[model samples]
Target: MPLPKPPVRRARNKEDNELLIKGMTCALIGAVVLLAPYLAKSASVQDLMRQAYLVGWFALILGCAFLGRYALRRLAAHRSAPRG
Candidate 1:
């Protein structure tokens, strides 16, 4: 019997997935910021602001991490690419 063919490669790569996930993460952060006050109107506004601030920081860190990873990968690829 003939051997099976190799699996097909996907068009999307690791960086694309990372970008998608980061985007979703940031969107959730925004959603939380918008939803928190409505969900807990009785609580002090200052407390909600504090919670949103924390979420903002997390979103910032996540975006930075993704950006750094993407940059390093592209730089490595550029350095390793064959020059004509």
Candidate 2:
């Protein structure tokens, strides 16, 4: 009897998956940083958190952009695929 063949994996698919994971991680980190001020009790800590607020926003925006790019690529690929 012949052995079962393994599933094929494409490089583009792997890269797309990586992008999705990276975007999720960045968004999670940004959310944590953005909420840090509320969790701090010390005035100095809150002040630091305020300073880091811009960084959090940047990360969140970047993550959203990455997610958007991934979605667009997927949509384009789906649209271009031939129907049976």
Candidate 3:
């Protein structure tokens, strides 16, 4: 008699999902900050926004990095799975 194959587990990783959510949030915040300057009419507010432009860039880059990491992890997991 042939042996039975083990069942595959499709458990989801909470941490990975959280990371994805965080990334999305950061990206949204960064976008808002970057665009706020264009919408502001006051010179003072525009100046402040311009000064904080670097912060927006940082947040955007960080968010992209997190997203990239999540994607890489998922890809690695998929590649490591046993073939049927």
Q: Between candidates 1 and 2, which one is better according to TM-score?
A: 2
**TM-score of candidate 2 on Cα atoms, chains taken together:** 0.79
Clashing pairs in 3: none
- Across residues 55-75, which tens digit of lDDT does each residue of candidate 2 receive? 999898888888988899889
Which candidate comes out best when scored by lDDT? 2
Query: What would the per-residue lDDT of candidate 1 be over residues 2-65, giving only the tens digit for each residue?
Result: 7776554344356556775785677567556656676666669747665676676677667667
On a 0 to 100 scale, what is the lDDT of residue 69 in model 3? Answer: 81
Residues 1-84, candidate 3: write the lDDT tens digits.
978875654345776787799889888878878988999999999989989998999888888888988898789879987797
- List the candidate 3 regions with Cα displacement exceeding 4 Å: 1-12
Each model's lDDT comes to: 0.65, 0.86, 0.84
Minimum summed lDDT over a 10-residue window in model 1 is located at 6-15
lDDT sort, best first: 2, 3, 1
TM-score (all chains, Cα) for each model: 0.50, 0.79, 0.76
Selected candidate, larger lDDT, 1 vs 2: 2
For model 2, the stretches where C-alpha displacement exceeds 4 angstroms are 1-9
